[model samples]
Target: MDAEQSIADEPEVTEKRGLFGRNKLATSEPKPAKTLGPLKMIWAELAKYPGKVALAFIALVITAAATLAIPAGFKLIIDNGFAAGGNPDDIGRWFRYLLMIVGVLAVGTALRFYFVSWLGERVVADIRLKVQDNLLRLAPGFYEENSPSEISSRMTADTSLIEQVVGTTVSVALRNILMGIGGTIFLFWLAPGLTVGLVIAIPLIILPIMYFSRRVRNISRSSQDRVADVGSMVSETLGAMKVVQAFNQESREKTRFEGAVEAIFDTAKKRILLRALMTSIIILFIFGSITLIMWRGALGVSTGEISGGTIFAFVVTGGLVAGAFGALTEVYGDLLRGAGAASRLNELLKAKPSIAPPERPQTLPLPPRGSLSFRNVTFRYPTRLETAALKDFNLEVEPGETVAIVGPSGGGKSTIFQLVERFYDPQAGTIRIDGVPLASADPAEIRKRIALVPQDGVLFSSNARDNLRYGNWDASDEDIWEAARAANAESFLRDLPDGLDTYLGESGTRLSGGQQQRIAIARALLRDSPILLLDEATSALDAESEQLVQQALDNLMQNRTTLVIAHRLATVRSADRIVVLEKGQIVEQGTHRELAAANGLYSRLAALQFTSSDAA
Candidate 1:
């Protein structure tokens, strides 16, 4: 196999082996968590706003207390207000007391909703910030094994689930627990015999609901996965719409998306069906028990063992208790879903970059020297451990020198740039910038001294000024124009409607290929780093554009150490030295004419290109 293809075909790491794996978002669902323990992560975030939490809890308690108080208030009204020959003033007083309880319940519920929802929104925002901060710290290899789109889904969908848990589910669960306990006590107070019967029936009400709930929970997870599949499909198809249309595969894409949508519908049906069954069981057991208790209470009332007021209070409070428990069963399932979301987010939060500066890091020397060296380097990508991209490679470039590397595809051309920037650590070798080993120096410091113009000009969705000054954020407008002039970008940039302030479309798509490449060259020029890496920088340009960019590069490289990777042999004829590589080893190194005369790999490659040019 070609070396480059071998490198590209490496298997992604699957150590965690579930949702984090590449393409796993649509293909797999994580195992359902056995408990709600993962929700503690959400609690930790909630704990940051202690005052809000306290207010919410206070409001929740008040609401529950007021809810139970209504029954007591009703008991007074029924027993006294309508008592035979009761005083008119006494009747009005009892009615007013009941109305007051209703008012308190209303106000307390609004407060509870406000505070809990505030906590929920605040926690999710904080978590998103923290997760994003960690994601930026990770190395490129991490992304190779993990799909960014899947990670984004976790950021959005999972966080939304957590928001619901914090804002609604937890609050509901707590309030109901208070009501269930408080209401049950009131029930026993009104009629002990009846409360006993109600209590005994509680397990029967909960058991069947729990059974159906387990089924619902499993299907709920699958339902979420199916929805994620639909989302991924839409994103994938839309992102490659041009390709789909170009190949006339629109129908195939439509069919694929329809399949995903149908899958979601199927999964949702199972979850909803189970939920419906659970709801039915809750009603049957709870109301049926309430009816039986009322029948028994009626007998006591007839015997004068209980007042009509007492029986009314008992039944009302008993209903509240039963309703609370029923709500709890549903709340438990929601909490578990939140726990699953928390677990996934927690993984991202806890992820440590494989490459990080050591404690007591060695600092690169002041007054940057454009010197770089690779010593006995033998390395394979994490995904492709069997094939080495670079093997026993050694080279050194002095300050202010230019070295051109030309080779067959996948001759470790791009791999050299990868290591120089410390994107990956070689399994066996030491790479140094200014004589400081990369592992001992901060990766940021190593990268600060090198500027790269990759095969493609990568730009962000921002204004031209921001894209131009990306490498040097502090660059003045004057400095920017100077760099642009050197990069042959100033002419067209000045012609833009908004000049430097014009918004560049995503990835600079509005710009032509040559224009984007020139912008990239200008960016590197603005960086003014000691060392430069040009990976086929002019390969994408037309003849005129290439000449202009090559001129700009010449000015840019005057005082810098430059490493150029090119397949076009004519471009490197003037380099200080040329190195030829094949099958991950350096086969020859010399001046271009010397290598051309030697009839080695470089000579043959140069012959192929120059001969083709002459024929054309």
Candidate 2:
């Protein structure tokens, strides 16, 4: 590609970073106190519907309290009910209270689940919206540094992790913490000796759990990044499916996609093994220590050191505390994953677009008479900063004048349009529209006066009416029909099954190349902008279609500033002036006859095309 020398910058600045693998942290690593601050961003979202959060918290408290109270009823059943008398009335009364506590626990648990789940959904939605809104406004330079697919993965995959943390993990961890604390206190009251033994075993149980937990967090983050890479690959391939199929590379794409899937599986397997190991260790320590304590309590009961009912209470509550602690290990893992997700989303929200409106931008004069000028401008694309796309380029088009630019490939013809549009700012010099520097004016306002018909004839996957109306949002049906007729597109468009309402399909695939080109012309015609840019606009049309479109172009150029780029010498022969370029410098300019008489670049280009036997 000749353009590579002009388009390629120094290799883009590369950051060696993991995908879903960002914000690395080991589970056993001591979390900084400030690690909670990022969570505050999530809390701010949770604060939005305070009523729902409050209701959920209240329900969680009720559920935890009810669960803790169940062991008390067990104490009554074993102590008083199993006494020598063993009264049926007392046992029945205690059973009734126990059933009541179970019922309360069931109701509170249901409510808590509902409220937190809803918050999870709502907060994720809010964060996604904020990220998307910010993304839409960022400068094009931002995209040059970031792949769109990765940005998309952040919006979806990252937010989903945040959702799990918010809706499920946080609620579970808080509830279990309450249960563990309450149960521990009851255990000491019921059997002090067993409590002492249980407390002594806790640190031993926790140590391994924390160690494996850090390993799981790291593995989980890596797995997420691999899955996102799969997403990016899919996006990249599908967007270029035509090229892939054209080259008969279907098997290659399939193999590539499968490799990504395998990468995700490999990472996930590591995480699963670590998590399973952690669970096994914690469970073994918990029940193993509990069993030893139970044996000692049995001896105490037989010796009358502790009552049978009291020993039972100690056993049950100790199990409850142990279970909660085990669950806490898993909850902590999820919180770290959620924090990683939140941090990614925060990065997007904090990005500021390189191109932004000036704080007090000068408003362009209304009813703009499009007069465009580029003065001593030099530019290099951000990705290819080492190569200048255009250097010291100078040109000016007066209002209502028509100019045709002819050049070899890489002569910076297209770069001219980009600079005028301010898609990028040049490294030096200035661009002005109607005597006002674009830097002092809003890009949107500058663009409103110019209309472009790019080489590809881009269109949305929408009905004909919508695609055409995109040129001028407020166009009336009559105005649209008039524009269509002027572009020589009204006949074929009317002949379609649904006329204006026909669905164009993606990139107008349902239409012929000539038809799509005409539709594009109609759209540009409808814009009725004061300045027009035609980049190989009629290149796709047949000879007959070209004649009609050219006639249409003549009308469109009337009393308008027109800049035309074309390979066909016939198209620009009648322009008010033709400018020939070589290596980003103007080599010649004049009327066709004037340039042809010079026997220079324009004459040579004409010799290749205009004098060909099959030339139109």
Candidate 3:
């Protein structure tokens, strides 16, 4: 046969087949995660874990309490032991006070670490679960808009970043604020005159904090995006490894991945350096202020205006004030960075799905016989609104009738299938099964009576039996085998080493195209619905395999209202009627012989394939 004829021909006999010939099924795109909100959403999530959050607050309070005690203990030791002519009993008393401070700090630090770590892990787990549940509720269109890696990044990297902010940053910021305030108050109380010079250092500290914090926030978000890009690249490449290797594109793929990694590293390095430099600057300011104050205190001690112990105590308290300021600066920067990331994540969590089921759905009465009527149905795909996918389409299929839909590519054949599945509602017009409007029906209930075998015959990463069981989850082994037999797949399946237990690798990659198609057919058979829809089900199979599957399909179609989107003329010829679609309109429709006699669109299609077959 010539090229087109050879492509269109199908035999009418059955045959045995081997596996290992199918292209992997197309993986669905990831859904766009909600955008993050500034800080409100982050706090909202924390509110979800109240008990743990309370524990976290308590730990923070204890940590701050212990931290404030350290400065007071040092002040007492210096003032009591070295100044005022040094008393033996007073020295022992100061040593005891210092030991108590160490003990309290050690315990508080341990508890704070434990609770924060626990909060981090728990929050991450909860966020992942929440995202997964939301994904399940979303319409299929969500996946079409995003990539798998993008979804995974939101579930993993984005949540982890938020976790770091929530579990550690918030606690540290609280502790530092308390310390910064308490340290300032004590410095004023202990050495009222020196506190003025310490207060002047505030403007110096605020400048660096504001500049570095803004930079940290921007760089943190950029770093997250770079990491997500790297993840997306890895996930897409590995998922389609077979295609990459088949085209011998390994070297090109490597270069692409390397570029992604380099971009991530470049961004990450900048973020790290900025954070380190900010910390260094804060540390320098803190110590620099303490050094200046100590010089003034030393002069007082030499003149005996301030005793030796008083000078020592004043210097030590001043150092604590500096340390607290440094911690506050670092913690504040962290808060800003986390707030930016939280803002993005909140955008995703807050989004409402475009397709939501009605709060009170109408109940549809089941028809005695499945009869579908498409009454002036019009639809436009979400992505392409300029051109109508289906415009005022009308069709009526009676129970036990087999109608074939024949058209060129993009002529709205798949759009009809999408409507039947309720994947998208018609923009205009009403479609009813058994006189009950689809829009008025409980969508889940309406779908239960229909079965579909799509062109791709996509399978999951599972065993043969589990894949078949997907159609009817509670099905027994006997039921599964019966469905396989109906699809002409049982014989081949029985020959596998483990029979029904054979593990089909990702997307049934181990099976041939024909074998996967049969498995899809088997799944449809298991559903055993009153209405069946087949979208080029056997188009990809070899002639030998197509004939066997066609026979199986004939048996399966018996007494069912069947809608077929046909690619091959032979299949269309056997239909009770053929509906010719052109540019989303059913321009012509009749029995194959009647349409051929009229020499319309059907006649032209037949002549193209027939003349080519004759020439071959």
lDDT of 2 by residue, 293-402 (tens): 87898899899999888887787777778778867876775687578678767889998876677888888877788898889989887777787878888888888888
In what order do the candidates fall by lDDT, top score first? 1, 2, 3
Give the per-residue lDDT digits (tens) of candidate 1, residues 291-361: 88788888998999998889888888887897799788777766886887888889999999988989989
Best by TM-score: 1
Best-to-worst ranking by TM-score: 1, 2, 3
Question: Per-residue alpha-carbon lDDT of model 3 for 175-266, expressed as tens digits?
Answer: 77777787678777767777788778766865786677667656665665667677778899899999999999999999998988898789
List candidate 1 segments past 4 Å from native.
1-31, 84-91, 213-283, 542-548, 607-611, 614-616
lDDT measured at residue 354 in model 3 versus the true structure, 0 to 100: 60
Per-residue lDDT of 17 in model 1: 34
- Per lDDT, the best of the predicted structures is 1
